[model samples]
Target: MKILIIEDEEGLRESIAEYFTEAGNICETAASYSMALTKVELYRYDCILLDITLPGGGDGISILKKLKENNYTDGVLIISAKNSLDDRLQGLDLGADDYLVKPFHLSELKARVSAIIRRKMYNGSNLLLFNELSIDLQAKTVKVHDTSVKFTRKEFDLLIYFIANKGKVVSKNAIAEHLWGDGIDIADNFDFIYSHIKNIRKKLVEAGGNDYIEAAYGMGYKFTGK
Candidate 1:
């Protein structure tokens, strides 16, 4: 899963990022409200870890308002030191899916993040089916007709993202953000996306799965699942 950690505490932010990255997921961080806002407006993430208090761009409440104003549908999990009832209510009212009080266990944090992602992406289903293709959300593995098919990290991520929005034309920009998070310079027309998709297609086809990904002329690519 792709995650963006919006926290001002540098140490905590790095810890969260490192923890998630080590778990084989793309993770990014923003130290202030401005950076977080810029990231929200420019890219997409499977889950966003928001902190209520920020140095710039007002506070996390305002950031939540901005996200709603933009109609961003991504999952949001607020992580704040403030444990006040009103603060939690306000954050929830503003569209945060989950709230985690600071000084909490990283294991719990991981579990909450995983819950949000599962709810958002798979509707709590670990198995994702697209014809003969199958994806195990919890295990991060793929199978074709019940036969396991190996995939690189990025390749697996891209395949799931494509299948989730199957039949929709997803632009290159969206693909880059979902797979690489804020790590890649997306404005530079990174060509590695094609290579990744190419490899995924080749692997699936070799494993007795159909090529569900279709190029949408000059616009983007579509997962025309059979």
Candidate 2:
């Protein structure tokens, strides 16, 4: 999952980002309201960890309003030191899916974020089914028909990307960005992505799964549920 953490505290922001990154999430941080606004305008996130108190002149609720105005209907989780009932109610009124008070456990935050994403995007279901294949997002397990299929980390990430953007032309760059973030240089990532895709395809086929990935020459791959 892609997440944006908007927090002014350097240590807290980094800690949250690192924890989520280790949990197979693409995380980005913004230390100020302006920076967070720019990121929200530029990229789409599965969930946003927004801090109600911002260093800049603007408030986090303003950002949420702008996102709603711009049709960004993704899950938004508010994180702040403001724990009053009024604050929580106001945040929810501004469209926050959940509220996490400061000094909370990272594990709890992760669980809440996952729940919000599942509710918003997956209809409160953890299992993502495509054809005869099923992926348990919470369990990080994949099954072909009724049997379990083992997969490497890369293979699982690739599959999740394909499933998330099902029936869409997923460019090599998109896959790379989703999997590796800004670490790998784009020119050097095509071969690696192809190899991962090849391995995932081979493993699924060997597991008695139908092929749903189609390659588009000079373009990208598409998951058509074929």
Candidate 3:
């Protein structure tokens, strides 16, 4: 999954980014409100870890309001030191999926973010089913008619991204940014993406699964399965 960490504290932000990245996720960090705002405006993430107190001009609430106003469907989990009832209520009312207090365990944060993403993408289900494909989100496993299919971490992530945005023509740049965070300089070439797509298509087809991914010529690719 792609995650954005919007926290001012360098230590905590780095910790969160490292943890998520180690777990086969694309992570981007923003220390100030302005940086966070720029990231939110430019990219879409599976979930965003927001810190209420920011160093720049606006607070995290303003970012939340911006996301809501723009109607972005990104899952938001607010992580703040302020544990007041009013703050929690206000964030929830403003459209945050979940909230965690500061100094919390990284495991707890991961669990909460996983839950939020699962709800948003899989309707709170651990198993994601599409046609003959059955994916176990928790296990990070995929099966086609009970026969397991092996996928590398990147392949697996790309498959899920395509499934989540099924029927939409996802641009190459979007796919690259989603797989590798915006911080990376991989936008100049799409050879890596083509290799992964080729592998995923071959594996799925060999496993008796339908070929649902279609290239959109100069545009991008789309998961056209119904």
For TM-score, the strongest prediction is 3
lDDT for predicted candidate 3 compared with the true structure: 0.94
Model 3 is weakest, by summed lDDT over 10 consecutive residues, at: 181-190
Summarize candidate 1's per-residue lDDT along 1-226 as a digit string, tens digits. Answer: 8899999998999999999999999998888888888888888788999999998857889888988999998899999999999999999999999999999888999999989888887887788877897788888889899789998888988998898788899998889878877666645775888999899889989999899889998889999855
| TM-score attained by model 2 | 0.88
Model 1: colliding residue pairs: none
lDDT by candidate, in order shown? 0.88, 0.87, 0.94
lDDT tens readout by residue for model 3, 1-226 = 8999999999999999999899888999999999999999999999999999999899999999999999999999999999999999999999999999988999999999999998998999999999999999888999999899999999999999999989999999899889888755745688989999999999999999899999999899999878
**Backbone collision count in every prediction?**
0, 0, 0
Residue 16 displacement (Å), model 2: 1.4
Q: How far is candidate 2 from the true structure (C-alpha RMSD, Å)?
A: 2.3
- Model 1 whole-model lDDT (C-alpha atoms): 0.88
Expressed as tens digits, the lDDT of each residue in 1-226 for candidate 2 is 8889999999999999999988878888899999999888877778999999997789898998988889887789999999899989988987899999988999999999999999987789999888889899888899998889988877897898788778899888778776765464546447888888888888789899977889988889998864
Q: For every model shown, what is its TM-score relative to the native structure?
A: 0.94, 0.88, 0.97
Model 1 TM-score relative to the real fold: 0.94
Of the two candidates 1 and 3, the one with more favorable TM-score, higher being better, is 3
